[model samples]
Target: MPDISHDFVDECFEPSTARAASADRRMHTELAASLHHLAEAVQTTDGKLSDSLGDFASNINAGRFVRPSVFRHYFQLVTSLSSGDIDATKALISKMNATPPRNAHRTITHFGHPDADQISLELISDGMRLAPISDTLAQDFGTLLEAGFDLMQNALPELYGEITAIVHEILLGGAPHGDSVEFDGASHYQFWGLLILNPKHHNTPLEIVEVLAHEASHSLLFGLTVDEPLVLNPNEDLFASPLRQDLRPMDGIYHATYVSARMCWAMETLAASGHLSVTDHETALKAAQADRDNYKKGLSVIDAHGELSATGQRILDKTRAWMNRR
Candidate 1:
């Protein structure tokens, strides 16, 4: 395990490939430990399903369980596999077995519904359900994302590297044409390397680029928060979020501040890259200003009511220092 918590905090503010690599190893180690505990629990229940545990372990070692959907299956296994019935465990194990190994160099973006065997997160909180993007929209989404990737790779190579390293797969899922709550992008810690984004928010490469930075920043927070929260405040105490319309917990506000800073950095870097068209350049610059304002606003809220831990304070200090840098 990485001994230095401050380095992890710094990585949250200014990500480097080496720092992200350390986080990756730490995350996988946690995954392995969780799987081991799950295996022990399963062995006491069903022999046949429990027998599959060895292959599951081997597959994990072979890098097969790294895919987001398969990794989510591991979440199901840990939560529900041995708690009660064995039937669901068998089916889930079969789904994990059926999951293809992650392709190393494949493009890391997809659009549409997850496979029928996959377990999608129930969005009771969002009051929205994910629907597949049409083929035309998917094609458009892919084009914009690739262009955004190009801009990031050219302008902020280090940030791009870190984002790509942490975010394995970017899945664009839309809600119906007009159902109320609209989310720009989301990352579930249990689905560590996955990003679920809405295509409506992605009209241009510059727009989508911010979403990439935003959601992947959430992934970075997730990695750091595996063991504990960055802030000490209870989630029951809700505060206004700079990004979302609803009031959020202190933790969510802390997350919003960090993500806003990152997205600001990404947009500023791209706007200054000389790669964008005239209109896109103007939009990027304007977005960067909005992000900067949001970052400061969210940080102020955290300083007031955040009740951050020592580690959280370190992160806030570093972020402040980074923002004030000349």
Candidate 2:
């Protein structure tokens, strides 16, 4: 496949530094007001809100009283919520209703596998329309997602919680248009709360777990770096990606490396759990090794070209430490 990294970067245009700074400030103010309004509306209508909504309000209200890192994480969600237009809000509300209640059995729709007729073409913050899936495809995708969910719950519950909270929906789609390289999945900073997956590319449960871990890592970084850039350099130069044949920007390489480390962790966990068949166990081992090697290469590129801010440095250090663990 031809490399389309340059085109992809161009298409996903970010606001200029000055404009972004102003937007960030405005977003913080708007988000705080929005949260208060949502909380008040819920209280007036329902007498009491769900524990999740209650915690959400409490966290936002606690403000600086909470740890800076924790506050920033919640702020990301607040910003996402505040940016939603009326249609987006309605769509989100409908999806939330379909979300399985905590501690309850998950249905096909819980993981975002809505029936064919129920699937609506919604536009994401990045101005791309999410693709709809047929009922047969949704059912097949749901089954794999459930297996992956169970593995995550048993092996990595904390990671699972973070991912589910950040990713409000998982839209099924083909490879992104205009990209010769086939993408198994993609996530955008503007759409910080969604993931788009090519179900055809990831048919196995183990494959699904890898993609989930990878994309969710991007979501986590998107939230943590909302106020700053991960690297100081411009996206002018294209560098070889360790995970793929395409050439990508330093930032993309950083994301790939970070997520590769997470993928390695997931694979190692599954391999050690003895939960897979002999063939599957072998595949996991091979995949884990490949991920580790690519991670190392990606990290080298970052070390050479990245100019991380304080928050970015902390995140990088943590991922490096995770990769180094026995």
Candidate 3:
């Protein structure tokens, strides 16, 4: 068992939820941290476990002494990931009505009672894949991520499918999926993981995709950098600009900069290729106009560094070329 941190009790949960002694025991742990633990736990080489939801539930329930407020706070945090009034994240997840991953071979488990809000979901196959905590009582983050991908793959089948192909080419140099280096980003095609951020803070799937693409792009550049701790006041120093400034100073620089740029670049590049409709391209253009500082800074970083990969340069050049043509 991993050591639970004291700061987690203080920093992770809301007061009402944290202090409630009779609260749902399964809901009391730090969810983000728990997800991390789930990711690690499911990776064990032990053959005794093939991934049963009931077994996971019994195991976690065994550890239950925490409050339900933790679950509430976790939802509150995830809900804030995107910026909007509609619970788009939840809506997106519901749309998928998710199935177990195609390659995943597992059983489902609730964290407390069989009737309790299902928390940890175990995917047991040749290996174990556990997804801890759901946005709703029925599904957890893994289910949500699968749903999001399904939504994207279906809604913009031609577009996202192509982007996925592009990401694959960049990361694998046209190699087959399982043959490539392991991916451990917020959302990766391998392992089938996607970090579902709150809709209120992010607002759109495109925005989320932008962040995901940045992480994907980083895999093409240098290998993923050792992530830094979140510094609440990273911008306290004037050097924290996503452009010109070194993104390495922040917790998720690739998401903060490169993936965001790659997303924009990909949208614009698609338009340039005449695959995206003019109106859609115009929408992408309008967004760039609306966030001129971010657009300009992203371009500036590419130009200043001359540091992007050939694929990265193609994305940057294509985006800029599209801007000029517009």
Q: Which candidate wins on lDDT?
A: 1
lDDT agreement with native, every candidate: 0.74, 0.60, 0.35
In order of listing, the candidates' clash counts read: 0, 0, 19
lDDT tens string, model 1, 222-274? 77665667999987999989888889999999999989888888887788888
**Cα lDDT, model 2, residue 303:** 89
Error (Å) of candidate 2 at residue 222 is 1.2
Residue pairs with clashing backbones, model 1 = none
- Candidates 2 and 3: which is better by TM-score? 2
Which candidate should be chosen as best, given TM-score against the real structure? 1
Worst 10 residues of 3 by lDDT: 167-176
Candidate ranking under lDDT, highest first, comes to 1, 2, 3
Models, CA RMSD each? 2.9, 11.8, 18.8
List the candidate numbers ranked by TM-score, top first.
1, 2, 3
Clashes of 2: 0
